[model samples]
Target: MGAPESLSLLNPARHAGGVFVNGEWQRPRGGSRVVTEPATGLELAASAVANAEDMREAIAQAHAAQRAWAATNPRERAAVLLRAAEGLQAHFDELALAIARETGGILAKGQHEVREAIVICQIAAGLPLQAQGQVLPATPGRLSIARRVPHGVIGVISPFNFPLILGIRSVAPALALGNAVVLKPDTRTPVTGGAIMAEIFQRAGLPSGLLQMLPGDAEAGEALVTDSRVPMIAFTGSPAVGRRIGELAGRHLKKVSLELGGANNLVILDDADLDAAASAAAFGAWFHQGQICMASNRVLVHEKIADALKARLVAKAGYLPVGDGASGQVALGPMIDNKQLQRFNALVHETVAQGATLEAGGSHTGLCYQPTVLSGVKPGMRSFDDEPFGPLVNLVTFSTDDEAVALANNSQGGLSAAVISHDVGRALALGERLNAGMVHINDQTVNDECTNPFGGPGLGGNGSAVGGPADIDEYTRWQWLTVKAALPAFPF
Candidate 1:
């Protein structure tokens, strides 16, 4: 079985069954919450819940630590991040299991998430050494310089889907850039998203109060956004929640990076390899149960090849396995919970009733939704308009390249899009026309690399990106300084 046989991987001593703040575990005044494994409906662990007071303490600790952390040698900060990457690698199995057990992602997906988290940490380790400023042109006997400095306390809010990756993508970079961080992971996957990061960083020699893990509810999140101590907020979740955070943060005059979800797309041109495109469609639409923000929301295909692609996708969906992730015997696991399951069912059923054809896979058993395939999905349909955060392969036909681009751009989201065609130049041309943050040619929509700036426009994100050089801009403030031999005398 791919499932972890026991909870042996979790060390109670390390996590302390409490929220991590000031580099130590403290029982949250909000009491404890029993985390349940989404795939099995089994008790995973009892995690501490941070209240408004706890959030205040976490932010205070972050503020206190940031001064010291920002003053440390860049090399020292780099060392901590590098060691944290090593720590993540060392505890890969434990983290992977926690991800699978808590989030309903299969073991393989958990492993992939851990690997991505490690890579991001390694990338961030080098950020401390990157160029932090520039020397500007100066008049004779004067020097002008521009420098980047850390935002004192950064509040990071991460989601349950791909928790480790999302959490660390912001946390590692913020800390590496000499900022202390207060991270609030989604309450559903606290261990993998919050406490586990604390454990790894603490072992990696991160200074006390530098990283605070406060896994709590919406109240805590609201408090973090509104708190003056948190000068910046990096959030990853749905567009609705992102908008609220943005509104709240804006009121506080805080800088915010909103990495929100989207109704992403996978476009298949008539000239594409049908087999490859079909496979990509299936993978993009169903991977991680389609909970990914970049998961293909709509498959826009040339009407000429739409029938063939739909047939292939329908056949693939019929046999794609669905069961408990802990068993490790399935291709797709259960939805995060019954609410998500019901939402998926309602969306699919409503779309089908609205003249869309449910060609394959519309049934469910408990929380395990079948890999669903729908055709004849038009722009106004619920399946086309709504973000399909489930295994629903929606096929929308377009007659021409212009029509495809028009159809793809007819959404509020602009996160990720994929264009598949044998002609590289043609695919690139079409991709350029798509109003998406990231476009893939001859590939699927879901892609991430630490070296690449990742974010999209419109409802998906706020046009600000993260990763690579983007982190330098995202986590720091630029200051311009000029100096002369003495203070220049003004006319008196």
Candidate 2:
């Protein structure tokens, strides 16, 4: 289904071109791509793809705008973010519908994403008021200070899943910290990811050129990463793509933050409540059809209770509704596209062929795949070793707590992990050793808060943090200032 008329800017004719740069929407130099609804295979909009030249212009415009923006007082910048948060809240329903229509997420999921984004906006609105520097001890008759400063222009490359949250989390904070942003959302969900932000900020009375939205493919993304004018880049996507961006940005000597892929695990200990653990696994593993980076790719259960938990997961998986989520009739929606569906199928089939038993759902009509479960999964299987962004959960049994930790930390990713146990102390202790960025005890892996530092090491992120005070380091640099009443006498 198409987006509501309130989101008409997604229409190519209304946008008048695909890119939003400098203060207005304009045509890009690159070719066009059709944005389709994965749930229905219907054309949602035709977005103008931005080529390298278009990206260059956007970066230059952002650089030009950033100087003046950074010169503004902290309160002024914070006020704009506060207003943007209100604007986002005002259009909550429309934004939620656009997310559902553009990304095939269920309406509830869309609403949740919008609400999270609004919270992020609200949190970011207060960033400017935070201490931006420190007083340094100096010699007598001298004053010294170190102040945080903006990085000028920041380039953000966001993925399709949870686009609004990912995009806003970076954009709002960057702008609040007095930096201009050039956002290149994944072309698949540009309306909800890019255009909506532009409309919200513009209505919130943001100055022109502070935020540029260019929805495009790899060529444009590379242009943003390699451009000399854009000194920092924030990317959220697959490990493969994040690596590419990291390498390129490193070569350019630019600061980059990456929130990449994960093979997150939900470890169910022997003493865990089977019903609660099973419900958590189902939601963590299959939410958003498992497209999320934090989605539980593997469910590791204690061998003592593996069979019981598996049965509950099988029963739950069998009953979850799967269909077009845009119709508001399903808990799980279609895969982002057929290409992703093919990949999910290949991984699941290969894992099953490797001797894992198909315990529950394992079929699909169109892009809506069943929430398949695999039992007897081993480390060598694709389902356990690879990051399959689909509705499939690999069930592996661990003999001891140490074995559970080893299995959970087996993957290259260190993004998120969850531990379920009746004993809170044991769960917390186990979680601390799991090598993940964020750990939830007695909860699922998929969790986020505006104030939480949201990133991991290794394949997950590149030593940079996001959210709350982390923005102070990610979006700005430091400048030292010293003054003396008179020139100190030197040997002459």
Candidate 3:
């Protein structure tokens, strides 16, 4: 693929990677990280690798903004979000291209993420209209009601994959409900994770200091989570890091929302349509090069249909081309960086060494590992027991329906599961038994929409209000209010 004909350099200031605090770009005090394009390993830009001192300054600014923004009219706040969506759409090209370059996603995938973000903004704009609390029956001459209130500043730590979508998914709702935010985009994809929003909202009339974009590494993340002024935190990343954040949250007793890792499973029964099952596997296992946390990590097929399903999946996967996402026609893109590329390769080698047959693509060049499929894999191997965030899928054979459900629930991180069968009732029934937050009947595991209950159970997520419109309350607190027509008789 050639450089996108429509793509051009972003504003020099944005590419320079200044942190946005108090509504303006903050130059690096000294240290910085050179962000390189993952697919090609070419220098894209230098982003500030902010330290604790820088983070403290950003947090202080966010607290001040939260207080001021809380006083603004909710209706006005909603209007700003709508306009921000407009801003995102208007600048779609630059934002999409940057996502492809930094994150190693194909152009189509980048465009898809941007679309989800636009809808998130549009939907979140209506959140203010729901702020009216329900009145409750009270003692005579008194009224009682519960009202949602913002929790000052929210510390948002986002990941590299789907940077824009995940970043805005948490950001839009927080802002809509009057909370200030200090966002720490992944060091791997600072521009899409931080700068894009900074630019979009700067033009969309959001007050200065309300949204701070800090492009930094784990050190900065530590600073954000420990900062008492922020009061609350939302994080989407690996479970190991999530646990560390959890420890800090407990230490401070701050509110936290965690969307963590998954070792998702896809199950196919003997009565299932092999064609549909194969197609679902290809889409769910290889999309984004299998970087999604909810990716189809393993396929469990009933022994009666395992061979046929394997053949169909290999054929379907062969038809899908692989290359740089900037080529505009790519499906599977490169791993985010060489480290991820190496980790992906290591998992594949380990799986085969554990007696699993290398049944499909396994060769690689640079960061582009082909979509892979393995058969006869079982428990104990990292490929079988752990989540590998790359385009690799392992096959396992199951006997009874009970066995299938048991295999699907084998992982500690059960985020999503899919059951495919001809009998809808059987599929639905199996779906109910799977240990996942989301189960897809007659489909695959990788699907997600803007308006669903998106988090999983166990270490998969903390379930602090995300996924649906009901999540508007995740970034908010509740307060009870009461009034009396006249002073009620005081009871001492």
- Candidate 2, residues 336-449: lDDT per residue as tens digits? 888989999999999999999999877899988999999999998998988889998899999989999998889786689999999999999999998788889999999987
User: Tens digit of lDDT per residue, candidate 3, span 18-131?
Assistant: 888888887856367788887787898878787888899999988887887988887899899999888777767777888888889999887787788888888888888774
- How close is every model to the real structure, measured as TM-score? 0.97, 0.97, 0.95
lDDT of each: 0.88, 0.88, 0.84
| Per-residue accuracy of model 1 over 97-160 as CA lDDT, tens digit each | 7788888988899999888888898989898898899999989999999999998999999998
Tell me model 3's lDDT, rounded to 2 decimals.
Answer: 0.84
Note each model's CA RMSD in angstroms: 2.1, 2.1, 2.5
Query: In model 2, which regions exceed 4 Å deviation?
Result: 1-12
**Residue 409 of candidate 2: its Cα lDDT?**
87
**Model 3 residue 332 lDDT score:** 81
